[model samples]
Target chain A: MRCQQVRRAWLEPELSAKARRHMQACPACQREWELNRRLNEAFSGWEVERPLPAEWDRRLQQRIATARTGWRGWLESWRWRPHPQPLRLAAGALLLLLVAGAGLYVRPRWFSPRAVKPASTGIVRDLQALNQNQEILQCPLFAGHGAGDLANGAENMN
Target chain B: MVIEDRLTGRLKLSADVLDADAEQMLRFQAGDETAFEILVQRYRRPLSGYMDRMLQNSPVSDELTQEAFLRVYLSRRRYRPTARFSTWLYRIATRLALNYLRDHRHERRQLSLDQPSPVTERPPEAASPAPGQEGEMLADERCRRIRRSVAALPERQRTAVILHKYQEMDYRAIGETLQISVNATKSLLFRAYETLRRELRDLEEAR
Candidate 1:
């Protein structure tokens, strides 16, 4: 096996028998094994000196307080803000005024009375005008009829 | 006030019965703000250490750690109890670290500008070594060299090493935090170890 492969295999939790044999026969692979072992040992024994800062708690508290007072606090407060009686009353009055104004503006246009002429009155006016003008009764249909007969005929037609 | 005390007592009892971290998170979700402080106190040290190792800057680590906690607080309402709290917490921290590393690669050099440089004097342990102290100095030097070597690694490899070695996280959990598969996590760790071994091989020979 290549020394790189052997080195990688050595780092694994379980080394194969072939790799073990290679490590034994190959001095380079053995050195690689030793290096890997040393590295692991160093890692296992690695220590860090990490002391918390003196103002850690204070800084954190300040950060939390800032967060509480920032946008999130504003949003939460807005969500839970109380709606007062005066505001509700004002809103209702505004809605009622809007409805009244709309009805007043639209009523004349929608429901106004129209000047309507009856069909019978128009026919009666035309017949009376024809009776007053005897020339229009000189037609053959009224040849032997007087104004009385014409009126009687007109009534019958009606 | 009596009812409030009874409710708090019930919450505390339930929190004690369940997974501590998840229970605290649930309490925070239920509007118990004090429960969030408990979580912050629990994770502060480990998370700060992890960030320091990952970024190699104490101040940046501190800021990122606090930001991670703040993000947790902001997301309390959306939290679910389906997963381990540490896993979720680490996921947030890792993401923040990775993003900071990516955006601030150039700015990283400036992180140490404010700190006093270490070149003025050596500590007694490092200076005028006694016969028996030679080995101790060598060990300290080797450790410093190892830290430099680890820091010199590429970002992904260094993350893999820090998560696997320093954090003692399993391949599965590391994969989950890194948003990669188990095999990918293994490969990353192997490559990282290989690099570390190559970089620190001279230290082994010096011994």
Candidate 2:
């Protein structure tokens, strides 16, 4: 195999057996392999020597706290805002009570027999009182000198 | 079993740590403050080193590592235990580091080399005519040149190479962390290796 092909296949260890056989016969491929292996080792050795700063943990903790607080604050805001669940329940209960009370208050209008009779009686009495007042007003005794006119008019007044 | 044995067992099993990490995340989601602290202490160093390589700057890596952890904490409620917690955490750190690099693109490349490097002013190696020992010396010089060359690669390739070689993460894990397809992850590694091979031609010639 060519060096390029060998390098590509090197990442997969299963191909190592085939690559080794090919590398033995191929001098150019051997040189490329050696160079790549050496390069890999050197690159791996370029260690990052620095440690994390002293205050990093403290700062990270503070940030964590801030974020936690922010999240809680958001949830708390939602909680304080009128929850639709409770609001709907309360409104429904109120509507139910108002309907019930109205039903009780108006039951007599539909179901009370005496209510019908009293209304008719009161209207009839008002009508009779009106007729009586009309008769008295027409009587000559109620006003000026129409007494003779009234007795004369009484037979026709009916 | 005794408590001591149980504790020892728990500590000994690496898988238990994975489970514990997942549990800690759950606790954190449930508003456990101490769980967050445990998580921070558990991952601080490995994450720091990983971030250092990703960002290639110590202080910035430090800052961003903290930011990544904080982000993880803030997103605790979103955590799912399907993947390992470290994998998830590293994913966050990698993304934050990549963003940092993108944001700081205009800044000059600054090596936080604390003191004089051992081989400060070493001249470039030439392809020499001599034989045996010269071959070894040339090989050494080639290796150094290769490191410098790989480090000079574009950020994505560099990251792919670093994760593949240094972190020893598989293509699947890398894909998840990079938010790319597994095939794309392999392609990234392939391209990175191709670039490294081409760029290190000097080292190849020296041999």
Candidate 3:
């Protein structure tokens, strides 16, 4: 109810009933309220009166279109610089290098080279023999024919 | 339910205010240009109005308003919904406005240190509202005085007042935008109004 409370709570969206009741009884609070109203009115009116230029939206759109990011965005950012800021350019270059370095370090599997198994490494020879033996055991033709005959019959999957 | 609500481009303004700006921002981050356009459509006028109050409402303000949006666009990939989108936006705008003010103030000061500024008889930044009809002139004069008084305030107080009165931001939003506590923001507004009461006492007396 005090004048100080009214003054401080003036910015609150709604006034407390206690503050409102005291403001009605207090002359100084009335003036304070009136001043607040006028200030807000002046500010609000100022905004309403001074409209932005018609071409602002167009200019903004132009800026955005040209600034659509990527290689072109980078070029556009430094595009018209008759005299570019070297520090910024250097920082950008450094960033590019770091990104490239990280990309190289974390190359994905698809980007990685397929290993050449030397065609006859000992482990590969062993695995191939084991695979053939398993297929022979599973094949009914292996019961009545030699492995070479079965191979010809299978046509080596020509 | 992780409750979702329509944004309607209006601030939630509650303690647990849900921000559709975050949703739109996330969409924008994911390459939805339409969401970015929506944000621009929603904010353009309000932001321009905010810059007008802060930058004395001129062509520069309009330009700076676009610059703020542009920065938002460029930073879209980096966008995180840490705070309300509007809060993040006002913070961007306040910085731009304040920087422009400071840089221009410096330029003006440098001009003053020289012989009369070669730029113009009166710099555009210091230009008053235009001439008008008698009633309009009076209103313009009132607005001018109010602007001058507000402009004379320290940057924080002036910013707090504009955000509070013009933007209709609640204390918490204001505090978050300003990176200050709610209590600090409350006290700041209180002190700003006090300063306004003292400075514009003549206008009150005339009334």
DockQ of each: 0.15, 0.18, 0.17
True C-alpha contacts between chains kept, each model in order: 0.31, 0.43, 0.43
Q: How far off is residue A2 in model 3, in Å?
A: 5.1
Instruction: Flag the better candidate by lDDT, 2 or 3.
Output: 3
Q: Which ten residues in a row are the worst by lDDT in model 2 chain B?
A: B112-121
Model 3 over residues A1-158: C-alpha lDDT tens digits?
67997888876778889988998899988987777777666666554345567888799889888777555466545543434478978987999999998988888854877776676789988999999888877787557677677679689678
**Ten residues in a row with the worst lDDT in model 3 chain B?**
B114-123
Write one digit per residue (lDDT tens) for candidate 1, span A1-158. Answer: 77778766753679899888887899877776677776776666556457778898788788878987899655543342233357756876899999999999999999898987766788899987888777767878678889798689789999
DockQ of 3: 0.17
Q: Which stretches of candidate 1 lie over 4 Å from their true place?
A: A1-6, A10-12, A44-46, A72-158, B1-19, B109-128, B203-207
Q: Which candidate gets the maximum DockQ versus the true structure?
A: 2
Candidate 3 local lDDT, B1-207, one digit each (tens) = 122332332223353544788788867766688998999989988998788777663677778999999889876655556578999999999999988888788663444332322211122234454555555555555566666677668888999998988788989999998899999999998898788777567864676
Q: In model 3, which residue pairs have backbone atoms overlapping below 3 Å?
A: none
- Return the TM-score for candidate 1, rounded to 2 decimals: 0.64
lDDT values for all models: 0.74, 0.69, 0.74
C-alpha RMSD over true interface residues, model 3: 6.8
Model 3 misplaced stretches (Cα beyond 4 Å) = A13-26, A49-51, A65-158, B1-18, B107-140, B204-207
lDDT per residue for candidate 2 within A1-158, as digits (tens), equals: 67667767766657777788888888877766665676686666656666567777777767666765786535533342222467757877899999999999999888876534455578899999999977887786667645577687788988
Which candidate leads the pack in TM-score?
Answer: 1
Candidate 1 chain B least-lDDT 10 residues: B114-123
